[model samples]
Target: LIKEYLPGVSILFPYRLLKTEDPLPHSWDVTSDTIAAWVAKQTSALFIKATDVDGIFGEEKVIKNILASDFSEHFDSCIDPALPEFLQKNKMECIIINGKFPERVIQAVYGRPVHCTTVKGNI
Candidate 1:
């Protein structure tokens, strides 16, 4: 279906197993955020997580940008539990933005500045 509709674009379904080999975990820890990051790592594309919140929050403040090395040093919110570690390990960055506002999604896709949290890769 993807080849006929989206063409070159690729989409990963966390709930659906493509095959018996190397399947993702069927646990809550693996949400769409982590799934997207995993897909990005596989496709060599950027990963962006659109959530209801503006971004990740810790200590009552929104962390705008952070490196993967320091990603574990903060409170977890707005993303799946396994996302940060997976992204860091794969050297893949992830941008978390507000899905409530559709424009932010476009901004994130284009690498434009948006009110979001950028979890840096291991580079």
Candidate 2:
């Protein structure tokens, strides 16, 4: 168990129940932006999202860097519906790093260039 290995860790679980028809109970309609705001204000944590690709791309073209506001404009085409809406509601800086790479996680956390979708704002 995590407590047995890491005693200093504290966990917070904010559970929400969706519609009865929905099968997933743990996840709500919350957006990534909302989560980011909470992270910034509530915890001293770094928010990073790892995915299957290098980053946010438009029609096969990769967008190296984009501000939060810009992301909102292009969000409909780029983001998935299942993702929390907080990502679009708040300007949370998140990186969609590559999950396949062995060191992608470390690179993103350390500010290194990793293949992924890096969205700093709404998009």
Candidate 3:
């Protein structure tokens, strides 16, 4: 489906969504965040997820920028546990922003100063 809409953006949606015969593994660790990142990888695009929270909370604060290693410490709380590993292995970054503030998404995409969290692949 992504290829059919090449150069365009679309969130990852499983073939049958909640239906059975799941093409992908059925695991709690493989949530929407990981699926979105996987689609971006296959398409060579950026990955983003707008969640309800302000951003990734860590060390008693909303971490604006963090390495995958450090973020993994709080990964289970912020996102699918497998995402950090996948991003690290692929040398990719994921921008997590608050859906309440849609404008922040644009800033994140531009790598600007936004009230969001950027999870980097490297140390």
The lDDT leader among the candidates is 3
**Number of colliding residue pairs in model 2:** 19
- Model 3 earns a TM-score of 0.75
Superposed Cα deviation of residue 64, candidate 3 (Å): 1.4
**Which window of ten consecutive residues has the lowest lDDT sum in model 2?**
16-25
lDDT of 3: 0.75
Clashing pairs in 1: none
Predicted candidate 3 versus true structure: per-residue lDDT over 10-72, tens digit per residue: 444556543543434567878877877876776798788889987777677888788877754
Model 1 stretches with alpha carbons more than 4 Å out: 1-18, 23-27
Note the residue pairs that clash in candidate 3.
Answer: none
Please report the candidate that would top TM-score against the real structure: 1
Q: Model 2: runs farther than 4 Å from truth?
A: 1-12, 16-37, 72-74, 77-91
State the local distance difference test value for candidate 2.
Answer: 0.55
Could you tally the backbone clashes for each prediction?
0, 19, 0
TM-scores of the candidates are: 0.76, 0.57, 0.75
**Winner by TM-score between candidate 2 and candidate 1:** 1
In model 3, which regions exceed 4 Å deviation? 3-26, 71-76
The positional error of residue 39 in candidate 1, measured at the CA in angstroms, is 1.2
Tens digits of per-residue lDDT for model 2, 1-123 = 012346776544433312332333244444443443454434556677655666777778777776655544346533444333444455456666666775988988888876666656554
Which 10 consecutive positions of candidate 1 have the poorest summed lDDT? Answer: 14-23
